[model samples]
Target: MTEEELRQRVAVAKKFMSALPFCHALDMRIDEAGISEAVMSMPYDPQIVGDPETGVVHGGAVSALMDTCCGFAVNLHPECVSPTATIDLRMDYMRSAKPGERIFAKAHVYKATSTVAFVRAIAYEDDPENPVATATGAFVFSKSRKAGKGKAADKSGAAA
Candidate 1:
């Protein structure tokens, strides 16, 4: 991707993050974004702790992060012409996240058809190899929107 295209994708990712109330509540931020991939981070917070004694963040919070990251990956895919919604997501928890550590989710679009995109993501605290959870998901995009000359079109059918 060209520098301009990368900038555009990052802009769109930031806009998407800003518009989500849950993202704001979780303090999620984009770390990097590219053609068909994205990385997002969420700081550990007491409010989202699933176990008070252990201070582990809730599974639901991690789910949201993975889902949102997957959506971003789909939205930035070259063939995707519009915004996407999660059709299905399957997550496998390997272990509880370490307390007081920020969590990061990295997602990539592995395949895209006319209607659906397949994604794989991993959520980890410090090392990508040792993931706290792994997820696979399918996202659906609009058939009505058409891809623009050099960029994926938005839901309004305009180049993003």
Candidate 2:
């Protein structure tokens, strides 16, 4: 895509996602942009507690951020559509992300086909050298056999 087009598309995606009910509440924001990569960040939220004693962010929330980050990375290709689902999502939690800490993640699209895409990313708490978790996922592109934007997939093996 042209530089201007890229800017416009990024702007559009940012506005679309930023306005999302869940995304807005979590402080999620698109952080970086490129042809095959994207970065996103979210601050700690009281609503995302998985364990009260540890003040850890819920694993589900982490997966949500990772999924969207990867999806945006794939969509950066300029030929992509919004209707996609995570075929598989594997998250490796090296360390629990603390509730007050910020999570910054960068996602890369390793490869893509008409039906499938491979992606990976690292998420850390303000420190790239010490990532809190890593993710690898397979996502499928879906289009209108009928009209719909498609649904986000479950982080587990369950279907979307």
Q: Residue 49's C-alpha lDDT in candidate 2?
A: 85
lDDT of 1 by residue, 24-121 (tens): 98999999888889999999999999989899999999999999999988887866667899999999999999999999999999888767899999
lDDT of model 1, residue 34: 86
How many pairs of residues collide in model 2?
0
Q: Which pairs of residues collide in candidate 2?
A: none
Model 2 agreement with the true structure over 1-160: per-residue lDDT tens digits: 7899899878877777777787777778888989868999998888888998888999889988888888778777565666567889899999889679888888998887656878999998888789988999888864322322233233223543
Which TM-score value belongs to model 1? 0.86
lDDT of each model, Cα atoms only? 0.88, 0.80
Tell me the number of clashing residue pairs for each predicted model: 0, 0
TM-score of each: 0.86, 0.81
